[model samples]
Target chain A: MKVLAPIAAHEELEMLAAAGAEELYCGIVPREWLERYTGAVWLNRRSPKGGSLDSYAELKRLVDDAHKLHLPVFITLNSPYYTAEQIPLVLELAHKLSDEIGVDALIVTDINLLMRLSQEKLACELHVSSVAAVLNTEAIRFLLNFGPSRIILPRSVTLAEIATITRDVGQQVEIEVFMLNDGCAFEEGFCSTTHHHTVGAFCTSLSEMDTQFEWAGKSFTTRRQNWLRRNLTDYREWVWYVNGNGCGVTPKGLPYGPCGLCAVPDLQRMGVASLKIVGREASPFKKLASVKMVRDIVNRTRAGVPKLHVIERAKQLRESPEHCAAGFMCYYKVDESA
Target chain B: MEWSLHIGGAHELASELWLSRFVEADRSQLTQPWSELAGRLLVTEFGDIRFTHCAFGNEFCEHLIPSVSALQTALTAAQQQQLSFTLLTPYVSNEGIAALRPLFERLAGNGGGEVVFNDWGVLNLLRRDFPTLIPIQGRLLNKSLRDPRVTPMYATAPAPSSALNVLQRSNLDCESYAALLTGLGVQTVETDNLPQGNDLSFAQYGLRIATYAPFGFISTSRICMAAGLHYRKADKFQPGAPCRHECQTHLLEYSYTNSPFGNRDQKFFLKGNSYFYAHTESMLHALFAQIRAGQIARLTWQPRLPMTVAH
Candidate 1:
């Protein structure tokens, strides 16, 4: 398996590549788009503030530099869907990235955009974004008609489901799974809530809401309501911790969000092609640490380490035994019976 | 415009008392049953409408997919009521697809009914093998902005018009998208009555529009909170964990206090794995107007909050 890390700036290229990142992906929103759409109408799913490169020149430099290190860079245009008027501008940007900037592939989500790409036969490859929410093998087979070389599975899918999907279609298309950082409470593709910095994410704001419970058209007792409220609060907190405690990092310079290092053996055995490290908007240090940690685990797995020892080694790197014990930060559910 | 009553499972169809009331109720006086189900008076104007179709099946969770026997019960009820049957489906894993295939086969053999698909794979399945079944794009596939927080900001915020347009617009406005759906054998698309309002001008694309009322989904999750309401803390948030259908019995209402989006009294309802907001009276009035103008061809009414079977 290869390590696909997020790249934002040209300067972070050397550090990430040195940290064992074989592949790189980033989002770029042009100045012209910002002047018009003003970041609210995101060209990509990410906020344009720090999540994306703001100029084509910067993207060109980053792509060129990463290619020199034998690393292929992918660009994200993975908003859930694009309107008719926005399609022309998006296609223009896709063309420039594929033709001029020499990007390796375009990570896309919109079905219409994928159809357009397929129709135009763009030079670069098309990797279906997780935002497209291709959860089933039938969905993968359906998407195969569009000719995407890779499919990034969503965070909502379980390890068993991933194994099934890869087993069914892994031979036809490369399968990528989220291995580290930034987890979503809901399936990102099905989530239609806006993610602007102004309004924040819908799920994050849910934790602050007061609750009332009704069953069969009657209110629950105060004690029961309060108990359920606590449960709901705990659930929200768990979701927050799994989503990286608002993209938090630990004292040891390791990321504090969702981790799937223990599942590396399962993913590798299932013929998974790549392990994606999310967070294009993360700080440079967090990116490097994430890449290094995943690289070490992959190396251990490749060296024929026992699966149990590899799982323990991965848990030790987090420096948070309580979270690992609770399985609060697990991206893929670990089978205890195993 | 036509009307359709959407229920979640076979139990709702088995209620002879409810079925009789729904069939014989006067259009102008039909709001009482819906209001009683919602715990509040939801729709005020029915405008001499009558339900001509009955839609069953869950759109958010694959676990809630109706079994083969349930599908038979729903089809029998629809036939007895002289209404067309529409089968609803959710985004599924390979297992979900497998579970739905038998139901699809039943529907197909029953002489073809309308099937609403929320996932592209399901649509592909229908087009490929179950070609006899009619495909309607489910509301979940209608990716438009339905966030309640941002809906209120559309009037007060000083954001650019283009930014707001992005919020108010949806794939329906795209000709290519409409063409794609039409190419895939879809003639009607389902959408929510968004609080920010909708532009149904896309009806010119020769595609009919079906809008759901009273409740619009804000978001859905595979990490079902309702399913784990009784589980231990360590196992509470596990994705794809088995459940006892706790969502069918409990309904949660969330109200924001000291909300940063101002004092709009934002309230959301959590049912099953989805969060929804009740449509305002003004939004319903606009929807009625749209129906009158012939822009909306169908109104799918959700009497209950989650559109699930009564407990």
Candidate 2:
């Protein structure tokens, strides 16, 4: 499997490529779009401030530099959906990125945008974004009608579901899974909440709110309610911890968040094509360390290491045995019974 | 205009009060014109709202999909009450799809009905195998911003008008989006009574709109907190874990004291796997005005807080 890492600026190219990134993806919001829609309407799922490149020239430079290292570059246009007026601007950007700047593919989420891209017959490959929420084989087949060359499964999917999907449609299209960083409390595709820095994310802000539990239209006993509240508070804290503790890195400079290294062999056996490292808005140092961490596991899996040993190596690399033991940082829930 | 009563189970269809109100409205509708039906609107409460159709099934969690026998029972009740039936479906995995195949077949075999698909896969299955069933795009797929926490931001923020417009609009605002649904054999689309309000101008695209009132969902997840309430810390927050439907017996309510948007105290309800906020009276009044103006074709009334009710 290939390592797909996030790229933000032209300067991060060499470090990420040297760290063993086989593919790169980024989001760019051109000046014209920013002037009209403002940062409030994001071109992608991330905030437009640090999340995307500001100009076409910057994107072209990044694409050219990555191509020199034999790394394929993909651009994200993966907002849940675009309005009628916004669709034309998005289509024009897709064309310029694919036809003019020489990007390898466009990672898109909206169904209407996909249909328009397929009908227009853009020169680049179309990789459906995980925001499109392809959870089952039938969804993959449905999206296949529009002709996406790759499908990124949502983070909410289990390993068993991933195996079933790849088994059914792996031959038809390449499959990608989230490997590290950035986990959502809800299914990102179905979540319609805004991610603006001003209001913050709805899910994260939930921790600050007060909670109460009622059963059958009556409040639970004080003791049970207290337990439920504590459970909720602990769960939210764990989710926050897994999401890089507000996108923080450890003292050793290793990125800390959700990790899926233990599932490398299972994914490889399932014919998965790529392992994606999320966080385009992250610093270059964090991005490089994340890529290196994933590259180590991919290499171990390729070297015919025993699955149990690979899992053990993955746990050791995280440097947080307690978190691993608690299973708070697992992206894929590995079934021990299996 | 038409009104539909949405419920999660077959037992809701057994309520004589609900059946009597719907049957009386159906009888009055046989003689009254469609335009005059708006005058008979009584927005007192869910019990008073007259409906012409019944929508049954879960729209957020596949684990809550009704059994085939339960579906049959609901269908029979709808038929006996002389109302149309619409089956609501959620986003599902392969296992969920397998479980729903028989129910879809049963619905299709029983002289066909409307199916509200929250997932594209379910829509694909309907178009492929259950051709007899008409598909209605559910609100989960509408992709509209329904966050109540940010409701005050739209009015107080220094953002441009275009940005706010994007937030207020739904996918139906795009002509190609509506056209795509129409091409998929969908003549109707569903939406929530958004806190920031809605723009029903998409009705011009030859697509009818159904707006759910009183309770609009903000977000949902497979990592069910309700399902794991009794599990240990190490076993908590597990996605796709089996449960005894604990959500049916409990509801979590949240109140935010210091909202970044404004001084208004924001509140939401967490039932099962989703979080929802009750729509304000002003929003409901606007919805009624839109319905009276012929923009919204249907109103799906929910008597309960979450669409999923306790037995």
Strongest candidate by DockQ: 1
Taking the tens digit of each residue's C-alpha lDDT, what string does model 2 give over B168-280? 78777888888899999999999998877787778889998887755688998887887877888777787777777877766777787657655446667788888887665
For model 2, the superposed segments whose C-alpha errors exceed 4 Å read: A336-338, B15-48, B155-159, B307-311
What DockQ does model 1 achieve?
Answer: 0.55
Which residue pairs in candidate 2 collide? Answer: none
Residues B1-311, model 1: lDDT tens digits = 67788865555555442323443231212223333333222233453345678788888888888789878887887787777888889888777899899999999999889999999889989999999999999988888877887765774578788877877778777898899889889999999988887877788889999978667888998888877778888878777778888777667777866367674477777888888887776676777788768888887766666436322
True contacts kept of each: 0.74, 0.73
Q: How well is each residue in A1-96 modelled by candidate 1, as lDDT tens digits?
A: 899999899989999998999999999988898899886678888888987998888889898888889999999988877887788998988899
TM-score of each: 0.94, 0.94
Scored against the native two-chain complex, candidate 2 gets a DockQ of: 0.46
Candidate 2's residue-wise lDDT over A31-65, tens digit each?
A: 88889987778888878889688888988999998
- What's the residue-level lDDT of B257 in candidate 1? 62
Error of 2 at B297 (Å): 1.0
The TM-score of predicted model 1 comes to 0.94
lDDT value, residue A294 of candidate 1: 97
